[model samples]
Structure formats: structure tokens, C-alpha cells
Target: MTNLTIIQQSPDPEQVAERSRTRRSIADKIRGMGQNRIGALLLLLATVVAILWANFATASYEAFWETHLTIGVGDLQLDFTLHAIVNDALMAIFFFTVGLEVRREFAIGELTSWSRALVPVIAAVAGLALPALLFVLVAMGSGYKNAWGIVISTDTAFLVGALALIGPRVPGRLRVFLLALAVVDDIGALSIIAIVYTANFTPLPLAVAAVGLVGVYFTRYLPSGRGPVYATLSIIVWLAFLASGVHPTLAGVAIALLVPVYRPDRRDVEHALELARTFRQSPNSEYARAAANSLRESISINERLQSAYAPYVAYVILPLFALANAGVVLSPEVLQGAVVSSLTWGIVAGLVAGKLIGVFGSAALMKITGMGEFGPGLTLDRIAGGAALCGIGFTISLFIVDLAIDDPLAQNEARVGVLAASVIAFILATIIFRISDAMHTDVDPGQTLLRPVDPKRDHIFGSPDAPFTIVEYGDFQCGFCLKASGSIHEVYEELGDRLRYVWRHAPLTQYHPNALAGAEASEAASLQGRFFEFERGLFTDQEHQRPSDIVRLARDLGLDVDRFERDLTAPEVTGRVQDDMLDAEAMGITSVPTLFVNGRRHTGPYDAQSLIRALSEGPPEATPEPQHPGG
Candidate 1:
């Protein structure tokens, strides 16, 4: 206390500013872990812990996960073992994330069109059918015939984790193919659960679930506080599904599909930003809370909830699930029986050999029939490697074991088979990927332009006098570009007036139909000094970008609607759009979200740290001349 009494703090504002900057830098790094690699590592760790605990402390492992728990009001109490709770309740959240990912892919990702989705859809169907056929053939007269669904579904988490372990040598497009295939596989798994695994169907609870979903649909339009409403409706749907005899987790998917993917109106967005700016300019507790609420209301509920639940589902729910379900007590007798069990052989053959054949064969058939062609970097060997990785179906396989097979012996045998097959798949995929990596030579297409900022023509933000300028050539309809917006905002926040951002259009018109219209809308808004506002609106609502919608957004943003409409159709505005496109073509910038920091092309990920590093290092020694004037 005596020593503390003499303590003093530095009055230098630079030191205080330096400390704040350091804290923000740390925060940026932490927030940049959205790639889910850490989640995969955590899942792997949980699985290892489960196996060690099952063998070393058998009684404790069983007793902990097997403990019964009950919750409800009055006589409406529901009871379940800890294991059941993890599977039936917590896993619903995980499944909800999967459903969101699926919806997002279908909405704006590579699967947005039939041309892109066709091969994956066919492959997934074949992937499911072949495994089931193989399982039935292996277990035909052996009584475990109905457990075919156990091997049909691929475990997204485990497969992704194994791929992540293979490092950056893997092609990006191949990863997209596997992820899309897994999503389609999940759809098939849900169909199987609904049709094949249900013991009985009840009309009352099924109807109640439908009503609960309707409530969720209406809640999307709520002016404020939709979270509690969604949570309540989700619970009702889950309970009804549980009583209806359909697997309860399917409710999560249904609810996720119902979440609104559209952005709020421009009035709401402007008001929300005003509130936020007011709070920042003059801090007060009331203003702070109001700004927070307003900002939350501005974002779509789907995005808000996804960001909120992603970490919890990834780290806590999945790790706990792995710990509870991955344990297989391998006694001498159990091991001997598992080695010879028809169920074990059926699962092993179905997952490993069956997945490889089903995935690769179906893809070949697609190419051979001229129904679909391979994506970029997806050669025969890479596809085969990805197909092998698809066999690592640990999580979902165990889930189906609990559903399709009632016999404990069969369950244990199936678990053992799943564990062994996953290891085999990982090893096989790694070797194949390594070989493919060595066989292929990495080629750089020499894209990404190093161009100076043209303040007069560009849609600009931040101080005009800033030393560093960040240029982003991006499309409104591209999902990755939309994701990059967050990273860009973070960098803007950290650098403040030290940095400026100039946005240029580089829409992939072949992929995004509304991209041209969106770009014109942004240009029109810029004539009224609302370019950033309109651009943000377009990015937030990729699905709702008709001409009428764009005009309505401008009108709501306090612009003169007639003037906006005139500017939207003006030849000069159209010329501006084409000018950016011409620049993109000249620079060989084929992809959206290409960036330049301080006149040097930034090739790294558009995350905060990477951008900051590029900025700190400054531009290259010689500045390349701008390809086009006023660009």
C-alpha cells in the first residue's frame, strides 16, 4: 500500500496512444481466426482425450457421460443421459451452423448455379447410394442390415480437420468441392434420418413443429429483440421434433433455412450508423447501449446469430460431443468380436472403399456423360485424394450408429470400424495429396495490379490527406468479397485517418447476374454523396438487387429519387463502371476483392494483420503508373 501510494502514470498522450494501438493489434489477431483451423485442432484434441480416458479410466468415463439429467416445469419434465443431451440437444446447434453454411453456399457461393452444383449433387447421391449398397451387401443375412445410413454421411468437421493438417499444398478449389459435397451429403443424411431411422410418426407433434417454424418466419421482420423470439421458437420446434419421432436435430436445419438472408432497409441502416457515430463522438452509457442495439438490428439475424454461435458450437459443443461419443471401450473380448463382426466389416468397407469408389466414380461418370466438368485445379488425382478424405466420417457415423442400430455389441463394433476407417482415410488421402502436390507445378498468373489511388474518380473513404490508401477491386455479390468487408473495416478502424480506402468495381458478371446493376447503383449513389452507404447496402443484401430495390434504397437514404434514377441510367455512370472493368482487364485481375495497399498489390489474405503489415512496410520503391487516367 505504501509503495502503491507513490505510483504515478504517464501523462504523455503518445504513450497512451501506443498502448491502445497494441491492445487493438492483439484484438485484431484474435478476431482473424475465423478460418476454423483452431476449431479443428480442438476437435482432434478432444477425440484423443476421449480415447485415452476410455481405456485408462473406464468407469469414470462411462459414469460421467451416462449421468441422467432432467429439465422442465411441473410434470412436463424431460429426462436424458448426458450423452443423449450432447447428441440430441447440443449437436442441433452444430447442425444449425451446417445448415447456415449450406444456405450461404446455395445463396452466393460456388453452388449458386445449377452448372456449379450439378456435379456435387450427383456425386453426393452416388456417394450415399454406393455406401448403403455396400453395407447391405456386407451385412445382408447378418441382421445389421438397417445400419446402412451409418456410413452414408460424411463428417464435415473431421474431414475438414484432416485436410487442414495437409497444409497449404492442397488446391483451394478442391477444398470447395469437398465442402460442397459434404453439405449435399448432410442433406442426404437428414433425408435418411427422416425416412429410414424414425421408429414411428406422430401427426400432432409434427404439426406443432410446423407452427413453431412459422413463428420463426414471422419473427424475422421484428423491429427489435428477435433473438429471444428465435430462441423460444427454436426450442418449441426441437421439442415437437423430439416428440414427433423424427430426429430433433433436423429442426435446426429447418429453422436455419427460414432465417432471413436479406438486408434491412436503407433508413434502418442510416439510423443505426448515426446512432453508432453519435456514441463514438460523445460517449455516454445510454448512448452506448442504444448504438449497440441499433447496430445489432441493422445486421441480418442469420449473420448475427451465426457470428454469435460459431465459437460456442466449434469449441465447447463439438469438443464436449467428441469427449462424450468418441470413447469405445476396447476390452480383449470386445476387440476380438469387433475384428470379426459383420457390422464392423460392413461399416469399414462402406466408409473407406465405398466412399472412394462412389465419389471418384460418380465424378468420372459426370465428366464422361458430359453432364459436368471438373473445377479449376481439380485433376483426377486431386479428386481421388479428396474422395479418400471423404471417408473420414467419424462424428456423423457415430451419430447414425446411435440411431440405426439398437444392439450395444453392434454399436461398439461400428464405432471401432469408424475409428479404424478414419485413420486409414487420413493416411491414404495424405499420401495421395503429397504425390499430387509433387506432380503439379505451381503457376503464378501475374495478376493483381499495383496502381495508384485516383481520388477524383474513386469512391473514397477516410481522410483525403491520408498517407496510405487501400484500393479494393471487389464485387457486391461475391460472398468472399462480402466477408472481406469486415476485415477492411477493422483495418480502417485501427488505422483511422492514417489510411484511406478507394473501392473499384470488378464484378464477375458470368457468376453474378445483378453485379452490373449493383455497381451502377453504387455509382449513382456516389453522385449524391452516398456511395459507401449504397455499396454497403448492396453487399449486405446480395439476393435483393433489382433495379427497383436499388432505387428504393437511394430514396430511403435521403437522396432525390428522380436524380438517382437519372444518374443510374446516365451514359457517364455506365462509362465509369466500364472504365473500372477495363482497368481490371488490363491488370489481369480476374478475381474480386483484389487489393492494393499504398500502391503495392497485396497478395496475402485480406485480414487485419496482413493489411496492417503491408501498410507498415509501405509501397514499393518505384510506383507503377496508373494504367488508365482517373481510374
Candidate 2:
């Protein structure tokens, strides 16, 4: 019997309930981590703490990391300094998480589609190449040429945090662009670490590691509760890679690549549904409980494992990594010498000047050559700003520096360059983005904090838990919304269930007098499961929008006419409609049919292709600060 079938046959109610609760807890935790702010804050705090500890409590900082730790059985043994453990072991988890993310992107995210992936891919390449070239030019023959990889990596946490600090004027598309670019940049960085930084290769262990990786790939078909097996195999792979002289962290990437992505199979889903139907008939049966458990297991192992591990890596491992690696003893004399050193200047130049030229220049080239263009809502000015922000290469840069340069003094100087460049990049990027913001449309300061879509409350047309969500705040009577509705419909038709389309009323009471009534009508129809029908009808027949016509449309759509009429003026319905308007207004949405695809604003033309293309690349829209009437 299939594991899920066996699971569904479980007799224990307590076990089923407990498992459900655990799953929900994991889902909640994953959602929290996805928001990015808390982890960013933690990383920043860790870096600051490390810097302070390094400069002030130098001896203790050094001693704590130097404390050796050993683990083994009998003659087989392994030893590591605390710092090495943090760097090599803890960072493996971090890289594994990164690998999962990269795999996801490649498998199903923006990177899956060439149309969406090209710009970011080009930009990432340019971003990496330019930084390296600049570093070489600046540091060549200056005893720091080996450290060029330091400037090549982008600190995703810092870049994201910096963007968050910039607030809502930063278009959602820019975040996506930067994120995709960083992911590609990461792959490049890790590859460099694997190939360029390897000291030597032991053939036997390398072959054994390859075998372990192959074994790991086949484990996907293995039965459930094989955690110990997977964990043991992973460690074996890691240690083998270590002995083979490749950066052991690449083993994380190798393992992640092998983890099967969990797209629900049609046959499995159908079987689960059949089991669920049977469970409904015998609700109290052990078989029913087992069926529920089976359904849950149908979710991919990769997704479950990634969720379970992501928070630990982000909040704990990464922060510890920052604490261990970011610490550089910056004494006055050391600082003075670092400033004069070409290593510092090379890093600074590579990070700031190289990133700017590379990212912006490549993007401009794409636009000029008709090769590719930025995603919707990403302007060149904003891209320039993003390019500037790319210079904040803090974490990975330091990791590379540690691996590339052996001399302690030289490492400190490179660290100095990294620190100075990060500060400079943040400042310069802020100014550029702010200016871009001012030059563009007047943005409400409240739009900085983007709100999350609550599937529980929001009326979604597709799967409520779809990976990409498009929320439109539109007024039925607005002509622009009418046009936008057609494009939105086209997008829904093309993307199918992969896209969740949510409609929120943003009735322009000042202009469209019938908009409020229209919104209420839609909400009222929603009471009878006719929300989308009413919405589609309204958009299709713009002229038939009065209260009487809405009632007729609801009737035609087979909604309970009496109930629809009664609910049209219901307080809750009115409140729901009003709430949507309030949300739109708070977000500084001054116009009709403002769209947020996966939380990012779609500021491009209201065409089907543009809207579809934008949503295809995921980014959340900035949330506006909610305000009541004069509250």
C-alpha cells in the first residue's frame, strides 16, 4: 500500500489532530520567514555585534572562535575550531536553503520562463563580471588580485534589507529583479568557491562523494520517516567533499538539486480525493484518519523539508555565520593602513562603481538592442538605484575573502573595503531611489509596507494557495477599470489556476457615483458563490450597473435573487466593500484598476501581455499604511 494510503488508515484521532496542528505551525513559521524583514534585522544585528566584539573585545572574540571542538567514533575522528564549525557546518545549512530556493526558481519560479529569466540573468552576469574586472584592475599586482571573488558576490540579506529600508517608493519589480539577479550571482559565487578556491582534490573521496550524491537522489522514492537515513547520507556526502578538497558547502547544493519538487500528481490527487470522499461517509473511522494523513503526505517532501529547515538557517545559522565571519579587528592603525592599501580601494571601486556600470549598463544594453527589457514597473532610474544597492555585498563577500586571502592583515584590509563600500552603496542608492521616486508619480509614504493577501478572507478566483496572486483594486464604473478588466481576464485565461485573481473594490466615489453600489452588488453576489460571475457580468456590461440592473444580473447568474437583494444593502457587505476602498486609498491608489501581482504594483500598460508578463515574475506590492477618514 502507498504510504499515504497506510497513513489514512490510522486509527488514532489524537495523532491526526496533532499532525494537523504541527503542519499548520510549520506553515505559519514558513510564512513569517518569507516576509524577509525579521531575518534581515537579525543579520544586521549580528554583523553589528560582531564588529563591536571584534574591535572592543578582540581577545575574547578570537579565543571564542579558536576553541576547538572534536567529534568522532574510535579512530575515525573530526576536529574543528568553533569558527570553522560555524563557517563550514552551519553555513552548509544556509547554502542548502539557498539551493532549495535556487532549485525552486529554476523549476517553477520566474527563472522557469525565459521571458522572465533573461533580464535578471543578463544583469546578474554583468553584475558579477564587472565587479571582478574592476577588482582585478584596481588590485592587480597589489597583492590582492586573488580576492576578486569578494566583490563578485552580492549579500542578498543586506540587499533585501536595504531595499526594505528604502520603503514603498521602491517598485515591487525592482525587488524581483534584484532578487533574481542575486540568486544567479550566488550560483556564480558558489561555483567560484568550488572550482577556483579548491586547494586540492583527493580522487577516492571525490568518487565516493559522487556516489553519495547519486544515492541521495534515489532516496526521493524511499518510504517516509527516513530522516535519519537522509541526514546520515548528507553528512557522508559533505565529509567526502571536504576530504576531496572541494568546498563541502557545495554538497548542500548538490543534495538540494536532488530533492524532488513536490507538484501534486493528478493520479495521487484523484486518489486522495476518492479517499476523502470515503472518509466523509465514515468520519469517525480509523481509515478516515489515515486517509487525511495520506492526503497531507501527498505534498512533496522537498517542500516539507525546506519549510522545516529554512527558519533555522535564516535566523540561527546565518546570524551565527555573520557573527563569526563579519568580525574584523579594526584598530586605528589597522584602519589607517587599510585605507592606504590598494586592496581596500579595489574592493570599494569594484562594489560601488563596477556594480553601477555593470547592472545598469547591461540593462541599458538589453533595452537598446531589443534583446530584453526590465519587467513591468522597473524603470531605468530605479534599476540604477538597484544597481547601486547591489554594492552592499557584505556576507558572501566576507566568506570569499576568508577563503581567498590567507594573510590575517590582508583579510582585515579587504574587510575594511567591504565595510566602507557597503556604507557608501547604501547611502548612494538611497539618494538615487529617492530622487527617482520624486521624479515619478507622487507616492504615498504609507505604501512602503506591503500588505499580505489573506486567502481566508479574500475572494480568490483560482486556487487560494496558488504560488502567484494578483489582487486588483478596481471600480466597476471606471472606464479604465473596464479596459483593465479585459486584460486581467485575458491573464486569468492564460495562466489558469497557477494565478489567484482577487478583486477588491476601490470605488472612486468622487468620480464614479455608481461605483459603491456596484461594489456592494459584487459582495452581495459573493454570498451565493456568484462573485466572479457578477464581477464578469459587470465588467462585460458597463452600462448595466445600477442597483436594479445588478439585481437582474445576479438573478441571471442564478444567485438567490431574494438573498442577493437582501444582502446588497447589508452592513457587512457594505463594510467589506468600504474596507477594500479604504485599503486602496491608504495605498495611495488614486486611480482605478490599480493591480498588485504577487504583492508588487503593476505600473506598466494595462495590456494582457504586460500584466501576464509582470505577474510571471513574482514580487509583493508595497503595503500602504491604513488610515481611517481623518483618523
Candidate 3:
């Protein structure tokens, strides 16, 4: 009886619901923060404060940033002004996060293949070249034609934040496209900074920096103490770059590129799970430590470092950089000079007009030539708006102004241009997006399925000639979908051959980062004639749909793992998932676990009883005719 009493009772349903709601609220807040909206606002506020301080207390504003600080150990010493510290040291970390993103995207994210990479790559190159060209064309007489680098790169944080603030109807695909383009743009900018901007090249320190980068690369193999090893090596590389007269910030990029990034390994995750079970049963410190280490090791260090550093880079370093660098005395005389200044107008035109024309024009040309294509729902008008937003070149634009221009007054003019261009770009993008949304309202509003059931294309269970059909649009990471899966199983059991169930992909990527990947993985499995088997495995272990987990599931299902891996990124497989997403978008189906009975959308509860009742009602009257594949 005492042993029975020791057993844990099931949690109260109300408590469970309340806890779930709390978790969702927390998750939503975290997602919002991840979107960089708060960070962008803070950056804007910092710029305003800097401008006001520069205007009101010019002496103090300049003095505070210029105040010198020294650090030494024995005979060796280094000295820097407060401004240099912020620009050189703090900004290195910022660049490191960018490098991590570049590495991840190239490795496993959107830019993994040439086909997937072409659209952004072409657009980014044009975006970079056109801005610089326009700047040179405008600033030639200003004797700052060489300062073309100022407008060549987009501030991704601001771009994303601005897009969020604009509140586009469906921004997911466009956002992904813009981020990919930004990554390429960053690579180009970093290259220019290293080559074109580096006036002095000291071979010895650069050699030392290479050695340090090599050391950092090998640190991945270190069984333990990898973190400290990476930190020490990174510092050495940074100091080497500083000594070599190649910007120390590039050291961040170099080190980050060398860091290993990959999806979690199945073996490591299994080991972590085992340790977790042990810790749960024994409740001991040894098992706890082992479990934690295993869990950490399962995820690549690149991803871990990104999670650790991204928030600081976004919320703290960027805003601080703005506060340090954006100070400019905007007196009437200065403002009047800026109004007629060719250098100022050059930056304005290059960023606002050049970026808009370059990115959109290149993408349009690519689409016309069949060289590349935009993702579904990312129409030309939307692309134009995103390109306009890319013109918000605030952070890197100002950084380059300091590097390219020597005169304080000239820097002020350039700063004024960047500020004005960003504002104009924001307003322009907002108007464009609003107009685009107004022009492209959904026709059916998700009342009925957009695509009819094609047994050849869609994954289906039971007979194709079944009298009742239930189609579900779901994300693997959605808890509601997981619950609905249970209800769906019960309905399948009750109805059997009478019901033909279809599974469609509708991954809520903003909330569930792994959902799209999971959808693709299922499609990959479908290529091997094991779609339902993989689907069952995914629904059963919805919490573990990482790349490694998906691979392991494929192996467990007796599918050809190599083929499955190959198919996972195959164009057709990805396109299939994208098709479902496109249909979902067209039909205005935003939420997951959405069910369609026959050809009509099912509303209300999705329990087994409710689903069965809906299925029995048959197809609704005047349902939209499903189009043929590719129609």
C-alpha cells in the first residue's frame, strides 16, 4: 500500500492545460525575441540617443567615445580608445555570429545545394555590385568614390525587424529568401573588407593568424576542454589579425568558418536519452552530469555557440555599436551641407534605389531565364518590397563610413545619408508590401481544398476509391497535431477501408523550426515507398525530428539510408513539400491540424468522433474543383 501510494498520480487536466498555455506563452515570447524586433527598436533608439547627445552635448559625446583605455601584462601592453574597443573587439563577436549563420546555411540550411543557392547568390551579387556602382557614380566628384563599400551590404537584423514591423500577410518564404541573400551579401562585404580595405599587410602576423585558425579547426576533435581551446585560439587569431593590419573582426569570421557544424548524431542522442533515464531512476549527480554532457554533445558546437551568442549580438553589441558610432553633430550648417553633398546623395541613392533595383531586377531576370525560382507565395511584388527593405544599411554602412572617410564633417554627412536612406527605405517597403497584399487576396479563403487528391502525388492510406476522405495539414512539431494523430489513428481503426486519409505538409516554421525539415524527410521517405511508416515514426517521436533522428528512423524502417539521405535534399522532394505549403498559403490555411472532409474544409473539434461524423457527411456542395497537378 505504501509503495502504491509512492507512485505518481496523473496530473490534473486543468493544471496540465494551464501549464501548456504557460509554455506556449513563453515559447511565443521567445519566438518574438528571436525575430529581432526588440533588438532593432533598441538599435533605432540608440541611434536617436546618439544623435541627440551629439547635438546637445557634442564635447562630452565625442570625449566619451574617444577616452583611452590600456591593458598590459608585464612588458607587453595594448592601448585603445573606447570607440576602437567597441568597433574592433565587440564587433568581432557580432561578425562571429554572422559567420556561424553563413556556415550553417551553406552546410544544412537553405543554401546547401547549387539549385537552392542560385537565386539568392545571383541577387546578392547584383545587390552588392549595383550599390557600389551607384555610389561611385554619384560620389565621383566628392572624391569619396572609393567609399562605395558603405552601401554594398544590408543590415540583416534591421531588415528582418522592419519586415516584422510591416506585418506582411505571409512572410515566411520571403523572409527565408532575404536571409539567404543577406548571407551571400555578408560574404561579399567581408571579402571586400579583407582585400579592398586592408591598406597594410604584414605577412608574419597573418601567418600567425592562419596558424591560430588551423588550431581552432582542430579543436573540434578535442574530447574535452573544446570550449576553452576555441576561446584561447580565437583570441590569438584576433590579436594576430589586429597586428597584421587586416581588420580583427575578420578573425571572427575565419574562426567561425573552421568550427564544425552538423546535425545531432543519433548515437549521441541515444546515449543522452539513456543517461537521462538513469538520472530519472537514480536521481544522482554523476548520472545528471553525464546526461547533460551527452545532451550538449549531441548538438554541434556551431549551433550551441549561435544560441549562446545571437542574443548578445542582437540586443547588446549592435545597440552599443550604434551608440558609439552614430554620433554626428547635425547643426543647421551641417544639415544644409548634407542636403547638397554629393557623397551624401550617393549613399542615399545607392542604398535606397540601387538595392531595390539590383536585387529585384536580378531575381526577375533569373526567373525569366529559368536559371532559378522564388519559393511559393514569394511573388514578384513581394520580392520588390523585400529588396527595398534590404536598403536599410544602418550598421555596416556607418562602420564603413568611418573606415573610408577621413574628415569628421564628411563622416557626419555620410551618417546623415545612412539615416535618411534607412527611413526612406522603410517607408517605401511598407507601402510596397501593403499594395502587394491588397492586390493578392486569397480567393477561396481555405473553405475547400485547393488541390484534389492525387494518389500518385499525395501520401494516402486505405483504398483510393474509398467513400470518405480525410485530409490533414499538419506540422510534426505541433502538439495539437500529435494529439490529433492519436484521434486519427482511432478513426482509421473504426472506419478502416471506408476512409482514405491524406497527409499534407503545413509546417509552421516560425514556431517549429524543424517542421519543414521533417516534412521534407517524410517526402524523402515517400520516395522509398515507406511514407506511412516514416510518418508513424515521426508522430510517435515528434520531439526528436532533427536531421540525425530522421536518418535513424529511415534506417530503422529498413529503407536504404544512403538513398533516403540523397532524396532528403533532392529538388523534387523539396518541391513536393513546397507544393503543399503553396496550396496551404493559397487557401489561407495558417494553423495546423487542419482537416478536410472529402473536398470541403472541416471546422471545429478534430477528435475521432468529430472527424468520423464529418467524414460521414461526404463532400460539401459547390466545392472548388481541384486542379490537375501543375495546373
Give me the candidate number with maximum lDDT.
Answer: 3
Candidate 1 per-residue lDDT over residues 581-624, each given as its tens digit? 64554454646566777766666445565566667764324332
Best by TM-score: 3
lDDT string for model 2 (1-631, tens) is: 1011111122233322221100011011112324466777898899899999998999999999999988999998899999889888888888887888788768645576576678999999999999999999988867879889999988887787778777335345567678788889989998998888888778899899888988888887777656777898999999998898888888898898888774544346557777888888878778787787677677776787778997787689888988998898889888998888999999999999999999999998897787864433467888899999999888889888889999999889999999899999999999998888778666443333245677776888888877767787777776666666666666667667777888887666655556777888889888887788888898887766755677678878888888887776555576566446545534656565567866777654546655655665433232332222210
Could you tell which candidate, 2 or 3, scores higher by lDDT? Answer: 3
TM-score of each: 0.68, 0.68, 0.83
**TM-score of model 2 (CA atoms):** 0.68
- Candidate 1 overall lDDT versus native: 0.75
Shift in Å, residue 297, candidate 2: 3.2
RMSD from true fold, candidate 3: 8.9
Better of 1 and 3 by lDDT: 3
Give the whole-model CA lDDT for all candidates, comma-separated. 0.75, 0.75, 0.82
Position 614, candidate 2: lDDT: 61
Model 1 lowest lDDT segment of ten: 20-29
